[model samples]
Target: VALALCVIFNNSPVGSAISLIGMMLCLAGIFVLQQAHFIAILQVLIYAGAIMVLFMFVIMLLNLKQGENEGWASREKNLLLSVLTGFLAIGILYKISQVLFSVNMDTPASLPDSFGTVAVIGETLFTDFVLPFEVA
Candidate 1:
C-alpha cells in the first residue's frame, strides 16, 4: 500500500526508483518471515542496495522529466484496478495460508530447526550449485 503511494505520487525517475527499492525491501521482509533468511538478505543487498543505487544513478544522469497530464488519465479506472488487484492478492494469500495450515492437520509439531547460517548456504551454493551460481 505504501509502495503504491510512493510510485503514484512520485513523478520523477528518482522517486520511481526509490519506490521500487522500497518494494524490494518489502518483498525481502516477506522472504525473511517465510524462513528464507539467505534469500531475504540477498534480495536486500542485490536489489534494494546495489541495483537501486545503479537505477538512481542512471535516472540522475538521464535527467528525465515527468510527462504532463495526458488525456484519459481516469482516476476511476485506476481505483477500480487497484481494488481488483487488492482482492486478488488477498484471495491468493488466503488460499496459500489454507494449504499451509492444512498440511499439519494430522500431527501439529514445530518445524525442525533448519541450518540457515551463511557458511551452510555458501557450502551448498559453491558445492552443489556451483555452475548455476557462476552463470548467474
Candidate 2:
C-alpha cells in the first residue's frame, strides 16, 4: 500500500492513510493468532486508535491536495521499480514458505529434569562464570 500510494495512486494521502489502517489491522490479527493478545490490543490501541487520529490531524493541518506536486518521481521509473520489487518479494515468500513447511515436529518420550528451570539457569550463569558475572 505504501508503494501503491507513492506509485500507482500518485501519493494520495487518503489512500496512504487507508493502507496504514489496513496494515495495522493485519498486524493486530497476526499478533492475536500468535497468542500475543496483550500486544495485539496494544497494537490496535496505540497504532490504529491514537496514532491514526494524530496522523489524520497532521494530514489536515498540512492542507494537502492531490492535484499538484513538486515534480515527483517519473511514473515509468516507479512502475519499473515496483515490478522488480514485486518479483523479489514473491521469490522471498516462496523460499520462506518452503522452509516453514519443512519443519518436523517430534516429541521426546522423556524430558530432562531441569530442561528450563530457573535454578538450572542460575547455576549455569553464576557457577559457570562467577568472575565474568561479577565483572558485569
CA lDDT of every candidate = 0.81, 0.73
List of clashing residue pairs for candidate 1: none
Model 2, residue 19: displacement in angstroms?
A: 1.9
Candidate 1 off by > 4 Å: 1-11, 89-93, 96-114
> Weakest 10 consecutive residues, lDDT, candidate 2?
1-10
Instruction: Tell me each candidate's TM-score.
Output: 0.71, 0.55
lDDT of 1 by residue, 31-96 (tens): 988777999999999989998899888889988877886633668656866787799789999999
Q: Model 1 reaches what TM-score against the true structure? A: 0.71
Candidate 2 residues lying further than 4 Å off, grouped into runs, are 1-10, 67-74, 105-136
lDDT of 2 by residue, 1-136 (tens): 4433443444677667767777787888888776556668878999988998899789888988877655546787678767977987899999999977886547435557665455675787788988987896
How many residue pairs clash in model 1?
0
